[model samples]
Target chain A: MATIRDLARRCGVSVATVSRVFNNPDAVTRETREAVLRAAALLGYTPSAPARTLATKRSRMVGLAWDTGHRGPGWRHPFLQELLVGLKTALSERGYHLLMLATGEDADGHLRAVRRHSLDGVVFIDDGTADPALTRLAESGVPCVSLDRPVTGRRATYVTSDNAGGAGAAVRHLYERGRRRIATIAGPGRTHPGAERLAGYRAALAALGLPLRDEYVVEGDFYLGGGHAAMRRLLALDECPDAVFAAGDEMAVGAVRAALEAGLDVPGDVAVAGFDDIEPASLVRPALTTVAQDRAGFGAAVAAALISMIDDPDAAAPPPTVLPVRLVVRETSGPPRAG
Target chain B: MATIRDLARRCGVSVATVSRVFNNPDAVTRETREAVLRAAALLGYTPSAPARTLATKRSRMVGLAWDTGHRGPGWRHPFLQELLVGLKTALSERGYHLLMLATGEDADGHLRAVRRHSLDGVVFIDDGTADPALTRLAESGVPCVSLDRPVTGRRATYVTSDNAGGAGAAVRHLYERGRRRIATIAGPGRTHPGAERLAGYRAALAALGLPLRDEYVVEGDFYLGGGHAAMRRLLALDECPDAVFAAGDEMAVGAVRAALEAGLDVPGDVAVAGFDDIEPASLVRPALTTVAQDRAGFGAAVAAALISMIDDPDAAAPPPTVLPVRLVVRETSGPPRAG
Candidate 1:
């Protein structure tokens, strides 16, 4: 409940001096800082930040926007949260701040708030370049960056993982495991990673001299429910595949459950693989074989890229950088059963 | 790549006028604002934020100290990430900026950098009160707020979930399912939530008139590996309990695998329950029975609380608010199997 004035008065210094001690301690002598500290301790004082921000114009805040993709804030999605930490870590160095922009809020309305609030820059995570919010942000002339998905022709900066390469590797792994009749559970077509992953699956199949089984591929909405439904479609096919490669761990997890329900033994009767080697992949029964994306590295790269862009939006040609991925062979996949 | 000068020249206005137009469109007449915008578009101009921050001392930034936790940046953790979005939403409204702070950065070394860079306030997510970085922020007089755990001594404001109450609800649900001799895998004791959950488990047992059995409790680090090891110990017991409660879904998932490995059917031979009802909880075989935390609501509440503190730090009273928790009975627990 103590105010700054009380501490300043107790320290026998002006309020500005006390503020300087807190804000720019190096500007003031150590002795003066010690005195202010003693006074603050005596009065149990915590400085008022909002009023200070009004005066200094440095709220030490940043903005974060993410698309949870229908299932609001699913606890299963750890990849997005990790990227956030990487972004936050990069900004915290210079005492920068972070703020969250809620989803489903009106687009133009949100931009008005960002402009009026004076955000330094906004970071869009997993959102396509074409999101209405990005359009408004660009129109408002706000410095913005994207993670995992580029905002198309917009001059905004972006960072993303190598979804194509990862998916390709996953299929390649299936081939190496002697899975010729391999199928895929593709993600929604609208999403960037989903499209890239689908392309990777196709490319891998073509390169491996295997006929592309269109009926084997089904689009999943990237949720357990969608994955379950998609798996059912794959099963309904007359020529059921020997292996299934899902675009995400969630879908792979569902596929595993679906396979079990049909009285099939995982890895023994049919092989299963997934991308995003999520936490539960290893924890789940049969221990899913997955492609691991280095989430921390990806997050750090995005943060660093965004910071660099903020420093020099026109420094050099900001090329779209893609991080690498690896296929983790676990208990989910094995050699095809002898005919 | 167009500079402010080019835009000003195109608008037939001074550079200062152009800057003012970007900062405060209201300050300029409607005609002048329109001219500036047209000129900026023609020149492909974007305002330099750093220069403006230096001049106005408003970086429009906020600092975030995110807990990447032991698991790293998986983005799979929806609860943490959703809270982040909520925080971003509130800060964006104030025309402020957001920055992701590296968890271990020190203020003394980066004092000038922090001041030179503008920050309005610093928000810590799931960071312990005793963190060295937070201590420095306090000493430097930075305004900070925490989520999920209070920084003791009121050094900063906090928003947290009711961990104890949530755990208690899960235990009570198990009792109602007619499961006695309930064993539990407790999370690491160092964390506040983990400790609270352990307390809740004990309290519920006491309330149900069941003697707390020491052998029935095992320590888990909230991961599958730990849960697997803990389950092994429980199974090794001469007379193991019929039901198990794992503090985290990940642990419970491991426990499920362990039980199946021992030839026990879930909820038939040995019932299993978990907390955090993560996506895998339902996706895994037998669809885990667990407790569900409203992650978005938790995030919204935390963001609301932090913003309130940012608005008025020295309010008459700071009430500690606890969000309610609920039990979600699934396939995990039921009446004990007949002998």
Candidate 2:
């Protein structure tokens, strides 16, 4: 209930003197500043966060800008729960609370929203969609770090799993299992992860001396329905592939269901592999074999890079941080049991 | 980039007049307010959120007070991801941003934190831990709605799944499967859900002309290890139970795993059921039969109640809203297939 006037009156000073003591202490005598501060403490006249931000140009709040609503309706990050756990744990230890900013109708609107909120910095969740607005924001001077997408800016960086490497490993893992006729349910090429993983799949087939048949690759939208349709297409090919790899686990789950619905035993007739070993991967029947990204580690790394950008405005934008991924050999793609 | 002085100069008004136009428009003349507003629009000198909060004591922010860190380490809400998606969708529609307030060391600190952040209201995630801080917060004048718990205050209400109804249904379903000697993995009695679910189990047995065997009721922490340990204890009894109902899905999964490891068939040797039909329930082998809560609906209801309270300060605290839940019959607790 106490105001600046109360503090000023209690300390026998003008309101401006009280303000200067809190905002620009050097403008007042040391004794006067101390007396005002002591009075402020006594009267519980603590400055508000907004006032402090206006004075210091910093709010201990990080803006979380996610593009899910615009990218694709109902498109959820596979391991988002774990990602949040990681982000909150790391951000809390560093004394910053995440203030999720709305992904407005346009690029400039997002910038305006951030300014209105007066966020210190932002962590953008690039939903692997080639968003022009996200691209423009990345080029802005506001300190930021993105997830699963790359951008070029004076103070911008991105972090993602080794998409290319994981895709190639999935292909190689299938090849090592003696399935030369391998097909893939690839994601859309517009996304960074999609493009990179597709290139990796192609490169892996070339290295293995297997002809990359055009019909073997089906483009998907990293969703279950897309994967099921893509798999149906792959299954209907003239020469059905003996093995399949999906760029994402959701599609892989869909693929497996499509195969089972067609009365084909998984790993017995057509081996299957997926990326992003989310929870459903292990829970599904014949558990899915997939590329496992360090979900929590990815979130933590994003927090670290963004904090670095926030703390040092003059620091150069760091290079894209690529987290490692490994193959989880579950029943869906593992070797058959001994007879 | 334009300051109040810049705006005043552009509008040919005093600096105090420019402030008055934005802060206390009623005090300014219509012509002068229009002139200041035009200048503000031209000069891009909009008042910030903090400034607006200071002037009008309202922030379009809802504090998300979760007691996870203070509760048991590594305890996660089974359907947190969905709950958040629900909350975000509803909050965004109403033009409110969720500000996750950190659960500090004690109760009063939470109040201080809310005040420091200038939050308009709070949503306390009472993690069924009998938290004193959460209780105190609900009792405060700050508009708040709790999840999975209840409290009494002038502007406080809570929303939760029908724990008792869900639990009673789980027990009755097990009985329908011809398993009368049912055991239970109840959560801590100090919490609401745990206590209600346990009470339901007791009532269901008595209603079915069965005794409430003390040894058949084991206390669990609504966790996997706790469920596994409780199941092992029941299995070791001289007259082992033919069915088990866990208060939580995580614990039910543990119970199922333990039963399988002990060479018992789920829903055959020992029919099992769980609550909170989360994602893993359907994916698990012999899929878990559990109580399904409307996860997103829970968040939406919480938001609706909290927003109502915030918008209507004089409104009495609404009674605790209990959302309906249903039993999901799966391979884990369903009747055997006809030969």
Candidate 3:
């Protein structure tokens, strides 16, 4: 209940002196500052966030806009959890808190939520959809950064894993194992990551002088069930592929489960590889051999990008930063079996 | 950049009339509202969030206070992910956003972060520590709701799973399966869930007329590593238990891994049961049998409690609501093998 006036009256100083002592103590004499601090401590006076925000025009908050699309419980992905931890740690170091803006079923909901919040900047998780709201936000000059997906047709800074490069490495790893009949469970093509991964798969096959079979590719929703169904479809093919590479760890786990259920040996009968080495990748039987992205580094990069933009809005837009990915070979992918 | 005066001048109305159109449209006539809206749209005027918050103390933001204590990456737990999904869904429906406040190593950091933000209310995830900060927040009447852990000596609303009951059911189920030597991997004893679960384990052993052995109980940090270490210790004991019950599913997974690594058949040698059936419960090999708590329901209950308190702080504290948990019989805890 104590205001600047109350502190000033109690300390026998002007209101401006009390405010200066709290806001900029170095500008006031040591005795005056001590007197004001003593009165404030006694009165249990704490500066209000709203008043400070109004004065500084800085909320010291960043918005994390996540759109799960129609797929529910998207937070179940361990990759997102890792990213969240990284972002939280990085932001906290700068005295900023993360405000989650869950852009539910509707894409426009994200824009509306972002507009309503007094966020210093925003980091968006691309749901593989083209959202005009992002363009609008970028145009509004709010410091914005997209994670895992680039904002198409917009100049916003983007932080993403080397999706295409990771996918290519996975394919190359499989190829070196003498698995010529390779297949892929590509993610939905509408999203940037999915499209890049699929492109990588095709490019790898073409570079290796291997024939690209249309039946070898199936689309998945980057989830366990979708991967399972896609693998089953591949198994039903007249000539099953010798190796399967999934674009995500969840799907890779599902594919492995499907292969096991069909009475097939994991690396012996058919090699399985996945991307994004999530927690389950190592826990599952045969321990997935896939491409591992630096999730924490990716998160930190995105946060740094957003914070920089927030600090200097007029600075030239930073080039889209793509963190590198590496291959993690485990029991899932092995040398080709003797015919 | 356009102010209310600019809009009023363009619309040929007083500044108060223009302000009324934005703050309370119902107070203005339809013609006046239409004229002001059309002029405002043409002038590119948008109400600032800080100004709105200053005018109305309600920030429409809820804080999620997560204290991980000294353990890093504690937020990566699947249970927390599921709860976050549910909370986001429920809060989004009510036009509220979730702010994540990661309370670092310091116990008092949570209180400082919560106090710094203009949150309408906060949902605290008790990390099993006796935090005086929570008590102070509750005393300050910030409409606090503690989830999964109760704030002792405080009248704050609490929503948690039936830890004791769930543990009892898991133990009794093991007993009915004809397993006598049962051990438990308990959580940290300083927390509520851990204490309650330990009590339940003891109560069940007493009711079943089985002697409670002190060496059979090992404390874990509610993580996979802890569970794995504790299980290894149990395996090294002079009389290894026939069945093991872990206070959390992650620990159970670790226990199962430890047993399998030790060449022990799951149900035949050492049955494993866990509490808090997370996504990994069914995904892991030998599908863990554990107590399944309604994670989404728990999230909804916590959100509802916090929102209610925010809406009506004067309302009598709702009695501590405990959601039920059920035993999910799976491959890990099958019937005892015939001698």
Candidate 4:
């Protein structure tokens, strides 16, 4: 518990010199800096983080704000775990610790948490476009980054996966398999991913010269139950689709389960494709054919964007970053069935 | 941003009186407190968290430390997510935020992180018993609660599930089905759950007058791959087990996959059981029959223990709380096949 004054006295230097050595070593002479460091080492004097934060107005901590109020279909999805792993790794490398701020019942819970804690920056995941809190946070001068959902009229940097492109790939892959009747379990059109993925499904069908059948398209909540119900509806159709594409892996797994319970062999009766190559996608019976978005890359990019904004608050807003996605064909979506 | 001095001047009180009103309101008169509060509200004066920590030596923040170095078999398991949801719920109710501290490459990473941040308490999950860092943290006088992994000699509050009892239940359920030769996929012995579950498996066999065959027991990492490999090894044996119990649900799912891939029917040929009762256990084909631990209860118990300790550090070490477990019968471990 040695103080700066004690170090200054032990090193035979003024208190200001000792303080300068710790805060701005370049401003102090090399010899004086070495003397102050040696004295600090000998005396077991460590700089207090709170004191430094008070002086520098920097906490070196980042807030990860997410809305946990809704228990949606994607609640148990594994993509979140992968994203966290990546975000934690990148943040740790930069000497930052993640403070998880769950947006509680109140609409402004996240904003309250951010204000209570002195965070250098914040990263919001799944923040819809119309949250007035985001605008207030941006106006409060906190560097911000939005993931999955883009924020308009705010200086917050946006990072997301190539949802539209990945969805299109899934559709084309299904079409190339010679499945004349293709169905889709589209996600809710409220969120960015849901809207983009649904659009991709429609665009791909049009591009492939296939008529978009309204009865073949079912809107789902990007969850297993939704997929199961949607698949049941598809089965009741006069001409059942030979292939089904789900906007998410969880939904696809649900669809697979529904088909099996109906005594139908997957890929033999109906091909299934999904987005987000989560771990469960591979563990499921007929390993899911999915659009593999690099969850780790997405997390790292978001963290990097927020860190850069924190470092240079006045820097021009960087263009939104969209990570690429690739198709992973597994047992669920095999070769096209014979005519 | 109004300071205490400004509030004191506006309220016609001394600076010490205003400070006392904020830090120890009980020491001030009701009239004085009301006047100080009114002045503070009018001046828009808010107490800074760091400055309050400097005075009261409490951060009102909790640190969650876990080992991420080993990408072990349980890396993608759903138990952590369930536990986190529970912990977050409990912590939020107590007006606390979770600070995720990832233990990096350095063995003392957690310790350094703890020391740098002003955490009122900490909750350590899955930290090995042999970590000297835990002892150091205990000696550092920070209130701590260990989850799943019990740490001895540290006076730390311990909370865990009834692993042995749960495993015994799974075994007895298999025995009731008249399975003669039962096998077990045990978790790594280093972890508390792994060792306790193995003990339960052995105790159950002894109680049932069944032989504990060494070949019937295989060590796994509580992951899907480990279970798959262990099952493969069992299939190669001259006397393959009629029923298999995996220490974790993921491992059980893997075992089921292996049996199916080898053209064997689940329950009809080789019944399979698992522990944890994760979401996948019910979703996987055949719906794995397993032991169910109350994940949310465990999390809440741990959070409550830490909060109590933080509130009164001098309170006698409460006995470690062990939540009960139950057997959830599903499709996988059905009645033994007719001989």
TM-score of each: 0.76, 0.84, 0.87, 0.92
By how many angstroms RMSD does model 1 differ from the true structure?
7.6
Q: Which regions of candidate 3 deviate over 4 angstroms?
A: A1-47, A73-75, A102-109, A153-155, A207-211, A237-239, A336-339, B1-48, B92-95, B102-115, B153-155, B176-180, B236-240
* Model 2 pairs in collision: none
Instruction: Rate residue B288 of model 2 by lDDT.
Output: 95
Residue A100 C-alpha lDDT in model 1: 59
lDDT of 1 by residue, B1-339 (tens): 467888888778998899888878899999999989988767656565555554665555656665554344331343655566555656555544455655554433223234535564566665233465555654454455666555633335566567787778888888787778788999888766678788989998999998899999899978887888899899889987778889888889889888888998788878888888886787677778888876667655655555565556464214555767778888878666677
Per candidate, native contacts kept equal 0.35, 0.56, 0.52, 0.44
Tens digit of lDDT per residue, candidate 3, span A1-339?
567788888889998898898779999999999988988878867676667777776877888876655344453444776788788888888878798887654545555555455578778775656567766776566777887666642237788888998998999999899899999999999878888999999999999999999999999988899999999999999999989999988899899899999999888888999998877687778889999999879778987887787777578568889999999999999876678
lDDT at A121, model 3: 77
lDDT, candidate 2, residue B78? 74
Question: Per-prediction count of colliding residue pairs?
Answer: 63, 0, 0, 0
DockQ, all models: 0.21, 0.46, 0.49, 0.55
Which candidate leads the pack in TM-score? 4
Better of 3 and 4 by lDDT: 3
The sequence of per-residue lDDT tens digits that candidate 2 reaches over residues A42-97 is 77676677666766668778878776765655677777767776886688778788
Query: What TM-score does each model's chain B reach against the true chain B?
Result: 0.78, 0.85, 0.82, 0.88
Q: Model 4 segments beyond 4 Å from truth?
A: A39-44, A71-77, A126-135, B6-45, B71-77, B127-129
- Output the worst ten-in-a-row residue range by lDDT, candidate 2 chain B: B101-110
lDDT of the structure predicted as candidate 1:
0.71
Candidate-wise lDDT, in order: 0.71, 0.83, 0.82, 0.81
Q: Highest lDDT: which candidate?
A: 2
- Looking at model 1, residue B296 earns an lDDT score of 62
For residues B1-339, could you state the per-residue lDDT of candidate 3 as single tens digits? 667789989989998898899879999999999999999879867666666666677777788876654345454444776777778888878767788887574655555555555577788875656567777776666777788667542337788888999999999999988899999999999878889999999999999999999999999988889999999999999999999999988899999999999999998899999998877788788899999988879778987887887777578557777999999999999876678
Ranking by lDDT: 2, 3, 4, 1
Model 4 per-residue lDDT tens digits across residues B1-339: 677888888888898999899779999999999999998868657666566665666777788876554444236534777677788778888877788887665666665566556777788865344467766775566778887777654447788889899999999999898787899999989878899999999999999999999999999988888999999999889999999999999899989999988989899889999998877677777888999988779779988888888788687556789999999999998876576
